[model samples]
Target: MNVNHSNNKITETACKITDEICLPDSDLPRIVIIGGGFAGLALVEKLKHQEVQVVLLDKNNFHQFQPLLYQVATSALEPDSIVFPFRKQINGYKNVFFRLAEVEEIQADSNTIMTNKGSVSYDYLVLATGTTTNFFGMDSVAKNSLGMKDIRDSLNIRHMMLQNLEQAAITCDDDERDALTNFVIVGGGPAGVEMAGALAEFCKYILPKDYPEYPSSIMNIYLIEAIDDLLSTMSDKASSKTLKYLEDLNVKVLLNEAVSNYDGNEVTTKSGKTILAKNLIWTAGVKGQFPKGIDKKHVVKDNRIKTGSFLMVEGSKNIFAIGDIAAVISKKTPKGHPQVAQTAIQQGKWLGNSLLKIIKNESPKPFEYKDKGSLATVGKRKAVADLGKMKFAGYFAWLLWSIVHLMSISGFRNKLMVGFNWAVSYFTYEKSNRLIIRNFKPTSSQTKESGQYES
Candidate 1:
């Protein structure tokens, strides 16, 4: 991908060189970005017409809206609602290409990236591989716990919840029925809270309609957070409101609690209490999925890379890390910024502008985080919002959360479909899905590497 900067007023020499550059050779500077999550996707869009030929590599062909993935897992929305095709998104852009491959490792000495398909060489590399759910080095939990990171995880959870309900209704053994009806969520973050709430809502509304033979109150949804409060990143008012909302929806909120051990049928907590829950959903924490070549010393808490103020990795100029994979150094943020989509998007845009400055030989400015706002919805018509200098709760906040997420959805069709579903679900206390297709398997040895395949 050779790019020639031609001045039209120059002589024939410049045009001929430009014409010679029109044909791609081995000389073109290639920019290979990994992971089609928020950071890499945003970077490619911002670098559309640049000189560097951008190769965006990701395991899946679609870019997922992770914030709403829990809803999809809970069956409040469809699979297509939270995913967008990567190549179709960049089809009109002339400079970027998308490759579907699982990155095995990074070979920084030769500027090479190793993938399952083959090896790719890059003049410049940007890693946005993001994070994976951390089970605290517990092999049994990692093996037996269901997560909500991608589309497959969401569908798996959906299948698990629905199937468990059906099993509870049919099983004659009391112990088996009790296990099927009980659900345990092992984190207090937004993912855990939202998932727990959605499961509770399924019990209050959908469960009753689908299983008239069984009592809806028998379906137990438990949320266990290690900290003293839920949504600790948000305002105290928002946290209290969220707790109240979850309680209102009949979700048992267990704060200052942690998981000890969990077999398939029972979960023992750190507090010496045991719950017989067949479905153990883990959202406890996430660790960065950084490629191998970056210095191990740069890995901070949460396995994020230590990035300079300009979003460049320390001791490296052209190499950059952003999104959930990169951690900015700041005394104010000792643990790094929250692993959120907004942070990734902001870092990506800033890095894009900085790249332009690098091309023009100009000084790049440092990045400053903007404290926009935070929000979490518990159940229908209940949510909490924490905007800087302003905080709201209940109906208005829930309405705002709905609109913001709807607008944030990638495609127009997705937004419309989600909006339609929300309207219908609100009017009629019903979920579109009540059929239990299959029982959930915690983890299969043969896992689909990406969301391109369905279980």
Candidate 2:
């Protein structure tokens, strides 16, 4: 092992024989955490400067604020405003180190993990890789439609939308224009509803100013949900209010409808209804994502790893799971805790507070989830909330939603940027400049020559 030092502090190290990732050799027990999501980051925060060495591995170097990804998709916020670099997050934490690598396989027997870059050994392994968009094995819809799982997806949707709108202007055919402007969002969860609302706002405000030739009604927004209610996970009041809010914005809300098929041009529903839409945003579902090597039986519903009370993977010692990727199935939570940010954050914090004790052969209480309520915003000054017995909607709920999300962002600068953008949009109804910087080719068939659709 070759170690480099700066100012009497270990800066880097190379382990040539073991083929291990370069890291300062330490005598302390190393806890390698895969994924820098809410759970992993929370655990990192708790373990920092403590008696353990923490190695954080992630495919991306930045931690994204997922709750506001819809805003980015609809051009209400820029990508940079919602993504914080992982290095910036752990700058002062001496015990914590971040490496940019995608974990490919987990060799739990040897306490080793293989990655694209190199292999690393861990005294304890924590899986917090989180979830990815679930297309339900629909290959057509999966290929044609975009999912809002990350910042890149948000930007892709943005580029697709802007490019389609520009193409809509160029086409003389009315039917082609409708297809180009028609936006279909599948799934009525928080993500889908928020995206629909934001798109509706864009159609209401930005369309008229930007595209003076087309009528405001030219761009049609449709929100499709398999279930009968929007925000089905939320309260009934929230659901109804969301419906009313969306309808008021001229957004066509289709309940009990599921998108069965979608080529590059047409959206076919399960009920045999067809919607001609060039832009399709899928927010239907998500399943846990992690590298292979865990026992098949230990993996449960939604591809989540089955974890015991202490957030430890059932079949393994020294291997734990958290965040959306963990399904802590128990008598109380037969289906595991709700796959939401709060659950992930709480679980992360709990494990962080408890992991040290567990390592010391001390007992820690089982994870217990507290229902913190839900909030979904629909357009400006309109939102819904289910805060334990206090269900509310309209302006106040939206205000609360804004405050909560703003405070929850990772960095101070990001919060300021998002806040400033929101303040400007709130008053002026103006969004960030919709620039189609990249040519978004949704499909190879839809060419720039056809002028039918190319974003």
Query: Best lDDT goes to which candidate?
Result: 2
Clashing pairs in 1: 1-28
Question: Candidate 2, residues 1-455: lDDT per residue as tens digits?
Answer: 45654333444565456567887777778899998878888888899878788999988888888899899998999999998899999999888899999888999899999998999999999999888878888888877888888887888899999999999999999889999999999999999999999999999999999999989999999999998898888888999999999999999999999888999789999999999999999888888878889888999988889998889998888999998889998999899999888998888889887888877989999899999899999988999999999999999999999999999999999989999999999999999988988988776332111110000
lDDT of 1 by residue, 126-191 (tens): 888898777777767766777777887888888888888877888999889999999999888888
TM-score of 2: 0.95
Q: Looking at candidate 2, what is the lDDT of residue 432?
A: 94
Each prediction's RMSD over C-alphas, in Å, is 5.0, 4.6
Flag regions of model 2 displaced more than 4 Å.
Answer: 1-18, 443-455
Which sections of candidate 1 miss by over 4 Å?
A: 1-28, 435-439, 444-455
Which number leads on TM-score?
2
Steric clashes per prediction: 1, 1
